[model samples]
Target: MTTKNVRPKFLNLFRIHLPVTGVVSFAHRVSGAVLVLSLPVVVFLFALSLHSEQGFERVSEILQCGWVRLLSLLVLWALFSHLFSGVRFLLLDLDIGMRLAAARASAWLVLALAALVLIALLMGVLL
Candidate 1:
Protein backbone atom coordinates (compact mmCIF):
# COMPACT_ATOMS: atom_id res chain seq x y z
CA MET A 1 0.00 0.00 0.00
CA THR A 2 1.12 3.55 -0.66
CA THR A 3 2.34 5.56 2.32
CA LYS A 4 -0.46 8.13 1.96
CA ASN A 5 -3.22 5.52 2.36
CA VAL A 6 -1.33 3.67 5.10
CA ARG A 7 -0.82 6.84 7.12
CA PRO A 8 -4.55 7.59 7.41
CA LYS A 9 -5.42 4.03 8.38
CA PHE A 10 -2.69 3.92 11.01
CA LEU A 11 -3.89 7.19 12.54
CA ASN A 12 -7.44 5.90 12.67
CA LEU A 13 -6.34 2.74 14.46
CA PHE A 14 -5.56 4.76 17.57
CA ARG A 15 -8.32 6.38 19.64
CA ILE A 16 -7.53 10.06 19.71
CA HIS A 17 -8.33 12.08 22.81
CA LEU A 18 -8.50 15.86 22.60
CA PRO A 19 -7.55 18.08 25.49
CA VAL A 20 -10.26 20.16 27.16
CA THR A 21 -9.15 23.44 25.58
CA GLY A 22 -9.40 21.93 22.10
CA VAL A 23 -12.85 20.62 22.91
CA VAL A 24 -13.99 24.03 24.18
CA SER A 25 -12.47 25.83 21.19
CA PHE A 26 -14.30 23.58 18.75
CA ALA A 27 -17.57 23.91 20.64
CA HIS A 28 -17.23 27.69 20.68
CA ARG A 29 -17.34 27.72 16.90
CA VAL A 30 -20.31 25.36 16.85
CA SER A 31 -22.23 27.42 19.38
CA GLY A 32 -21.60 30.57 17.36
CA ALA A 33 -23.09 28.81 14.36
CA VAL A 34 -26.06 27.82 16.46
CA LEU A 35 -26.53 31.44 17.47
CA VAL A 36 -26.33 32.55 13.87
CA LEU A 37 -28.93 30.00 12.78
CA SER A 38 -31.27 30.76 15.65
CA LEU A 39 -31.01 34.54 15.34
CA PRO A 40 -33.42 35.01 12.47
CA VAL A 41 -36.25 33.06 14.06
CA VAL A 42 -35.78 34.89 17.34
CA VAL A 43 -35.57 38.26 15.68
CA PHE A 44 -38.61 37.56 13.53
CA LEU A 45 -40.66 36.74 16.58
CA PHE A 46 -39.48 39.88 18.33
CA ALA A 47 -40.31 41.98 15.31
CA LEU A 48 -43.72 40.40 15.04
CA SER A 49 -44.49 41.43 18.59
CA LEU A 50 -43.14 44.94 18.23
CA HIS A 51 -45.02 45.79 15.05
CA SER A 52 -48.15 46.81 17.00
CA GLU A 53 -49.61 46.95 20.51
CA GLN A 54 -51.93 43.98 20.02
CA GLY A 55 -49.10 41.97 18.47
CA PHE A 56 -47.00 42.75 21.50
CA GLU A 57 -49.72 41.51 23.82
CA ARG A 58 -50.18 38.38 21.78
CA VAL A 59 -46.51 37.53 21.91
CA SER A 60 -46.39 38.24 25.63
CA GLU A 61 -49.21 35.79 26.25
CA ILE A 62 -47.57 33.11 24.15
CA LEU A 63 -44.33 33.59 26.10
CA GLN A 64 -46.14 32.74 29.32
CA CYS A 65 -46.89 29.26 28.04
CA GLY A 66 -44.76 26.50 29.64
CA TRP A 67 -43.16 25.26 26.44
CA VAL A 68 -42.28 28.74 25.27
CA ARG A 69 -40.75 29.53 28.64
CA LEU A 70 -38.70 26.35 28.47
CA LEU A 71 -37.44 27.15 25.00
CA SER A 72 -36.49 30.65 26.12
CA LEU A 73 -34.53 29.22 29.03
CA LEU A 74 -32.63 26.93 26.67
CA VAL A 75 -31.78 29.79 24.33
CA LEU A 76 -30.49 31.75 27.30
CA TRP A 77 -28.25 28.82 28.22
CA ALA A 78 -26.81 28.67 24.72
CA LEU A 79 -26.18 32.41 24.76
CA PHE A 80 -24.32 32.20 28.05
CA SER A 81 -22.16 29.30 26.89
CA HIS A 82 -21.17 31.05 23.69
CA LEU A 83 -20.47 34.38 25.34
CA PHE A 84 -18.37 32.98 28.19
CA SER A 85 -16.31 30.78 25.89
CA GLY A 86 -15.63 33.73 23.63
CA VAL A 87 -14.26 35.63 26.61
CA ARG A 88 -11.95 32.70 27.30
CA PHE A 89 -10.68 32.83 23.73
CA LEU A 90 -10.05 36.56 24.06
CA LEU A 91 -7.99 35.87 27.18
CA LEU A 92 -6.01 33.27 25.26
CA ASP A 93 -5.24 35.92 22.67
CA LEU A 94 -3.57 37.94 25.45
CA ASP A 95 -1.17 35.05 26.28
CA ILE A 96 -3.28 33.58 29.03
CA GLY A 97 -3.69 29.87 29.75
CA MET A 98 -1.53 28.87 26.77
CA ARG A 99 -0.03 26.00 28.73
CA LEU A 100 -1.71 22.63 28.35
CA ALA A 101 -2.75 22.25 31.98
CA ALA A 102 -3.88 25.85 32.40
CA ALA A 103 -5.80 25.74 29.13
CA ARG A 104 -7.65 22.62 30.24
CA ALA A 105 -8.47 24.10 33.62
CA SER A 106 -9.71 27.35 32.08
CA ALA A 107 -11.86 25.44 29.63
CA TRP A 108 -13.58 23.55 32.45
CA LEU A 109 -13.87 26.74 34.49
CA VAL A 110 -15.64 28.54 31.66
CA LEU A 111 -18.03 25.62 31.24
CA ALA A 112 -18.83 25.69 34.95
CA LEU A 113 -19.35 29.46 34.85
CA ALA A 114 -21.78 29.11 31.99
CA ALA A 115 -23.79 26.49 33.85
CA LEU A 116 -23.83 28.51 37.02
CA VAL A 117 -24.98 31.63 35.22
CA LEU A 118 -27.74 29.72 33.48
CA ILE A 119 -28.95 28.11 36.67
CA ALA A 120 -28.97 31.42 38.44
CA LEU A 121 -30.94 33.02 35.63
CA LEU A 122 -33.47 30.19 35.66
CA MET A 123 -33.95 30.58 39.37
CA GLY A 124 -34.89 34.24 38.89
CA VAL A 125 -31.89 35.28 40.90
CA LEU A 126 -30.14 37.04 38.07
CA LEU A 127 -33.17 38.52 36.40
Candidate 2:
Protein backbone atom coordinates (compact mmCIF):
# COMPACT_ATOMS: atom_id res chain seq x y z
CA MET A 1 0.00 0.00 0.00
CA THR A 2 1.47 3.29 -1.14
CA THR A 3 0.21 6.71 0.01
CA LYS A 4 0.65 9.62 -2.33
CA ASN A 5 -0.09 12.42 0.12
CA VAL A 6 1.72 11.95 3.45
CA ARG A 7 0.99 13.87 6.60
CA PRO A 8 3.57 13.97 9.32
CA LYS A 9 2.46 12.18 12.46
CA PHE A 10 3.16 15.09 14.80
CA LEU A 11 2.42 17.92 12.42
CA ASN A 12 -1.09 18.51 13.61
CA LEU A 13 -0.06 18.02 17.19
CA PHE A 14 2.56 20.76 16.92
CA ARG A 15 0.28 23.17 15.08
CA ILE A 16 -2.61 22.94 17.48
CA HIS A 17 -2.73 25.16 20.56
CA LEU A 18 -2.85 23.57 23.98
CA PRO A 19 -5.32 24.85 26.52
CA VAL A 20 -4.29 26.22 29.93
CA THR A 21 -5.09 22.93 31.68
CA GLY A 22 -2.97 21.00 29.22
CA VAL A 23 -0.12 23.46 29.63
CA VAL A 24 -0.28 23.09 33.38
CA SER A 25 -0.34 19.32 33.11
CA PHE A 26 2.68 19.37 30.81
CA ALA A 27 4.63 21.65 33.14
CA HIS A 28 3.77 19.46 36.09
CA ARG A 29 5.21 16.35 34.47
CA VAL A 30 8.34 18.18 33.25
CA SER A 31 9.00 19.66 36.66
CA GLY A 32 8.51 16.30 38.34
CA ALA A 33 10.91 14.66 35.89
CA VAL A 34 13.56 17.29 36.54
CA LEU A 35 13.28 16.79 40.28
CA VAL A 36 13.40 13.01 40.02
CA LEU A 37 16.46 13.10 37.79
CA SER A 38 18.24 15.59 40.04
CA LEU A 39 17.87 13.51 43.21
CA PRO A 40 21.22 11.74 42.84
CA VAL A 41 23.21 14.95 42.41
CA VAL A 42 21.36 16.57 45.29
CA VAL A 43 22.05 13.62 47.58
CA PHE A 44 25.73 13.57 46.67
CA LEU A 45 26.04 17.26 47.47
CA PHE A 46 24.23 16.84 50.76
CA ALA A 47 26.43 13.94 51.82
CA LEU A 48 29.59 15.79 50.81
CA SER A 49 28.55 18.82 52.83
CA LEU A 50 27.98 16.65 55.88
CA HIS A 51 31.32 14.85 55.61
CA SER A 52 33.31 17.58 57.41
CA GLU A 53 33.80 21.34 57.73
CA GLN A 54 36.17 21.28 54.75
CA GLY A 55 33.63 19.35 52.74
CA PHE A 56 31.00 21.91 53.65
CA GLU A 57 33.28 24.71 52.48
CA ARG A 58 33.92 22.83 49.24
CA VAL A 59 30.19 22.41 48.68
CA SER A 60 29.68 26.12 49.30
CA GLU A 61 32.46 26.97 46.87
CA ILE A 62 30.98 24.73 44.21
CA LEU A 63 27.58 26.35 44.67
CA GLN A 64 29.13 29.81 44.27
CA CYS A 65 30.06 29.12 40.64
CA GLY A 66 27.81 30.73 38.04
CA TRP A 67 26.63 27.49 36.48
CA VAL A 68 25.88 25.94 39.85
CA ARG A 69 23.89 29.04 40.82
CA LEU A 70 21.86 28.75 37.63
CA LEU A 71 21.29 25.06 38.25
CA SER A 72 20.15 25.89 41.75
CA LEU A 73 17.64 28.34 40.35
CA LEU A 74 16.33 25.66 38.03
CA VAL A 75 15.98 23.22 40.90
CA LEU A 76 14.08 25.85 42.85
CA TRP A 77 11.75 26.35 39.94
CA ALA A 78 11.18 22.62 39.58
CA LEU A 79 10.44 22.23 43.27
CA PHE A 80 8.01 25.11 43.43
CA SER A 81 6.28 24.22 40.18
CA HIS A 82 5.89 20.59 41.19
CA LEU A 83 4.45 21.58 44.55
CA PHE A 84 1.96 24.06 43.11
CA SER A 85 0.85 21.80 40.28
CA GLY A 86 0.47 18.81 42.59
CA VAL A 87 -1.89 20.80 44.75
CA ARG A 88 -3.89 21.76 41.69
CA PHE A 89 -4.14 18.15 40.57
CA LEU A 90 -5.20 17.05 44.02
CA LEU A 91 -7.97 19.61 44.01
CA LEU A 92 -9.03 18.49 40.56
CA ASP A 93 -9.04 14.84 41.65
CA LEU A 94 -11.35 15.78 44.51
CA ASP A 95 -13.70 17.47 42.02
CA ILE A 96 -13.12 20.80 43.72
CA GLY A 97 -12.41 22.61 40.45
CA MET A 98 -13.76 20.10 37.94
CA ARG A 99 -15.63 22.61 35.80
CA LEU A 100 -13.91 23.69 32.60
CA ALA A 101 -13.71 27.38 33.53
CA ALA A 102 -12.62 26.71 37.10
CA ALA A 103 -10.01 24.22 35.97
CA ARG A 104 -8.54 26.74 33.53
CA ALA A 105 -8.49 29.47 36.15
CA SER A 106 -6.87 27.24 38.75
CA ALA A 107 -4.23 26.13 36.29
CA TRP A 108 -3.28 29.73 35.63
CA LEU A 109 -3.31 30.58 39.31
CA VAL A 110 -0.93 27.69 40.12
CA LEU A 111 1.46 28.84 37.40
CA ALA A 112 1.39 32.42 38.67
CA LEU A 113 1.98 31.36 42.27
CA ALA A 114 4.87 29.11 41.25
CA ALA A 115 6.53 31.96 39.32
CA LEU A 116 6.17 34.37 42.22
CA VAL A 117 7.58 31.83 44.67
CA LEU A 118 10.45 31.00 42.36
CA ILE A 119 11.36 34.67 42.07
CA ALA A 120 11.31 35.10 45.81
CA LEU A 121 13.50 32.04 46.38
CA LEU A 122 15.98 33.16 43.73
CA MET A 123 16.31 36.55 45.38
CA GLY A 124 16.99 34.84 48.67
CA VAL A 125 19.66 32.66 47.11
CA LEU A 126 21.36 35.41 45.10
CA LEU A 127 21.26 38.15 47.69
Candidate 3:
Protein backbone atom coordinates (compact mmCIF):
# COMPACT_ATOMS: atom_id res chain seq x y z
CA MET A 1 0.00 0.00 0.00
CA THR A 2 1.15 3.53 -0.75
CA THR A 3 2.19 5.42 2.35
CA LYS A 4 -0.40 8.05 1.56
CA ASN A 5 -3.17 5.45 1.50
CA VAL A 6 -1.90 3.49 4.50
CA ARG A 7 -3.71 3.69 7.80
CA PRO A 8 -3.29 1.90 11.09
CA LYS A 9 -5.51 -1.18 11.34
CA PHE A 10 -5.97 -0.61 15.06
CA LEU A 11 -5.69 2.75 16.74
CA ASN A 12 -5.35 2.15 20.46
CA LEU A 13 -6.43 5.12 22.48
CA PHE A 14 -6.30 3.26 25.80
CA ARG A 15 -2.69 2.21 25.22
CA ILE A 16 -1.58 5.81 25.21
CA HIS A 17 -1.93 7.56 28.54
CA LEU A 18 -2.54 11.28 28.67
CA PRO A 19 -0.95 13.48 31.27
CA VAL A 20 -3.15 15.08 33.91
CA THR A 21 -2.91 18.46 32.18
CA GLY A 22 -3.83 16.87 28.89
CA VAL A 23 -6.86 15.22 30.41
CA VAL A 24 -7.92 18.48 31.96
CA SER A 25 -7.59 20.26 28.62
CA PHE A 26 -9.65 17.58 26.90
CA ALA A 27 -12.34 17.80 29.58
CA HIS A 28 -12.44 21.56 29.19
CA ARG A 29 -13.37 21.28 25.55
CA VAL A 30 -15.89 18.53 26.25
CA SER A 31 -17.61 20.51 28.99
CA GLY A 32 -17.83 23.57 26.76
CA ALA A 33 -19.40 21.53 24.00
CA VAL A 34 -21.89 20.03 26.42
CA LEU A 35 -22.79 23.47 27.69
CA VAL A 36 -23.40 24.77 24.18
CA LEU A 37 -25.59 21.81 23.26
CA SER A 38 -27.57 21.91 26.53
CA LEU A 39 -28.20 25.65 26.44
CA PRO A 40 -31.18 25.35 24.12
CA VAL A 41 -32.87 22.76 26.28
CA VAL A 42 -32.27 24.88 29.39
CA VAL A 43 -33.76 27.91 27.70
CA PHE A 44 -36.76 25.94 26.55
CA LEU A 45 -37.34 24.63 30.03
CA PHE A 46 -37.07 28.10 31.50
CA ALA A 47 -39.50 29.50 29.00
CA LEU A 48 -41.96 26.73 29.62
CA SER A 49 -41.80 27.22 33.37
CA LEU A 50 -42.39 30.92 33.05
CA HIS A 51 -45.20 30.79 30.49
CA SER A 52 -47.99 29.63 32.82
CA GLU A 53 -48.72 28.27 36.27
CA GLN A 54 -49.45 24.80 34.88
CA GLY A 55 -46.20 24.93 32.91
CA PHE A 56 -44.30 25.91 36.03
CA GLU A 57 -45.84 23.02 37.99
CA ARG A 58 -45.03 20.58 35.20
CA VAL A 59 -41.43 21.74 35.05
CA SER A 60 -41.07 21.54 38.82
CA GLU A 61 -42.56 18.06 38.89
CA ILE A 62 -40.22 16.84 36.19
CA LEU A 63 -37.26 18.28 38.05
CA GLN A 64 -38.32 16.43 41.19
CA CYS A 65 -37.64 13.08 39.50
CA GLY A 66 -34.44 11.39 40.68
CA TRP A 67 -32.97 10.82 37.24
CA VAL A 68 -33.63 14.38 36.23
CA ARG A 69 -31.90 15.55 39.38
CA LEU A 70 -28.93 13.37 38.56
CA LEU A 71 -28.83 14.72 35.04
CA SER A 72 -29.03 18.23 36.37
CA LEU A 73 -26.06 17.51 38.60
CA LEU A 74 -24.11 16.38 35.58
CA VAL A 75 -25.03 19.56 33.81
CA LEU A 76 -23.95 21.50 36.86
CA TRP A 77 -20.56 19.79 36.76
CA ALA A 78 -20.16 20.63 33.09
CA LEU A 79 -21.01 24.24 33.78
CA PHE A 80 -18.53 24.53 36.64
CA SER A 81 -15.85 22.67 34.69
CA HIS A 82 -16.28 24.93 31.73
CA LEU A 83 -16.23 28.00 33.90
CA PHE A 84 -13.09 27.07 35.84
CA SER A 85 -11.22 25.83 32.78
CA GLY A 86 -12.13 28.91 30.85
CA VAL A 87 -10.68 31.02 33.62
CA ARG A 88 -7.55 28.89 33.61
CA PHE A 89 -7.18 29.40 29.88
CA LEU A 90 -7.60 33.11 30.31
CA LEU A 91 -4.80 33.15 32.86
CA LEU A 92 -2.60 31.23 30.45
CA ASP A 93 -3.38 33.74 27.76
CA LEU A 94 -2.12 36.47 30.07
CA ASP A 95 1.19 34.63 30.58
CA ILE A 96 0.15 33.27 33.96
CA GLY A 97 0.91 29.65 34.90
CA MET A 98 3.11 29.23 31.84
CA ARG A 99 5.53 27.00 33.69
CA LEU A 100 4.92 23.27 33.37
CA ALA A 101 4.46 22.74 37.10
CA ALA A 102 2.19 25.74 37.46
CA ALA A 103 0.09 24.63 34.53
CA ARG A 104 -0.33 21.14 35.95
CA ALA A 105 -1.16 22.50 39.38
CA SER A 106 -3.75 24.87 37.95
CA ALA A 107 -5.33 22.06 35.98
CA TRP A 108 -5.71 20.04 39.15
CA LEU A 109 -7.06 23.08 40.93
CA VAL A 110 -9.66 23.62 38.23
CA LEU A 111 -10.80 20.02 38.39
CA ALA A 112 -10.93 20.16 42.18
CA LEU A 113 -12.92 23.37 42.10
CA ALA A 114 -15.46 21.84 39.72
CA ALA A 115 -15.80 18.78 41.91
CA LEU A 116 -16.32 20.95 44.98
CA VAL A 117 -19.08 22.84 43.23
CA LEU A 118 -20.76 19.60 42.20
CA ILE A 119 -20.55 18.23 45.73
CA ALA A 120 -21.95 21.40 47.24
CA LEU A 121 -24.86 21.37 44.80
CA LEU A 122 -25.64 17.73 45.40
CA MET A 123 -25.59 18.21 49.17
CA GLY A 124 -27.91 21.17 48.89
CA VAL A 125 -30.45 19.18 46.96
CA LEU A 126 -30.07 15.91 48.82
CA LEU A 127 -30.06 17.30 52.32
In model 3, which residue pairs have backbone atoms overlapping below 3 Å?
none
| lDDT by residue for model 2 (1-127), tens | 9868777556667678999899999999999999999999999999999999999999999999999988888888889999999999998889899999999999999899999998888788669
**Candidate 1 has which clashing residue pairs, if any?**
none
| Model 2 steric clash pairs | none
Clashes per model (N, Cα, C within 3 A): 0, 0, 0
- lDDT tens per residue, model 3, 1-114: 655757778989989799888988999989988888889989989999999999999999989999988778878899999999999999999999999999999999998999
Candidate 2: where are CA atoms >4 Å away?
A: 1-14
lDDT of each: 0.82, 0.91, 0.91
TM-score of each: 0.78, 0.88, 0.90
Candidate 3: worst-modelled 10 consecutive residues by lDDT: 1-10
| Candidate 1 structure quality by residue, lDDT tens digits, 1-127 | 6555545545652477777777787778777787787799789879989899988998889888888788777777778889989988899999988887888889999889888988888779336
Residue 112, candidate 3: Cα error in Å is 0.6
Output the lDDT of residue 65, model 1: 88
Best of the two (2, 3) by TM-score: 3
Q: What stretches of model 1 exceed 4 Å from their correct place?
A: 1-17, 125-127
Q: After best superposition, candidate 1 residue 69: deviation in angstroms?
A: 2.6
Q: Pick the winner on lDDT between candidates 1 and 2.
A: 2
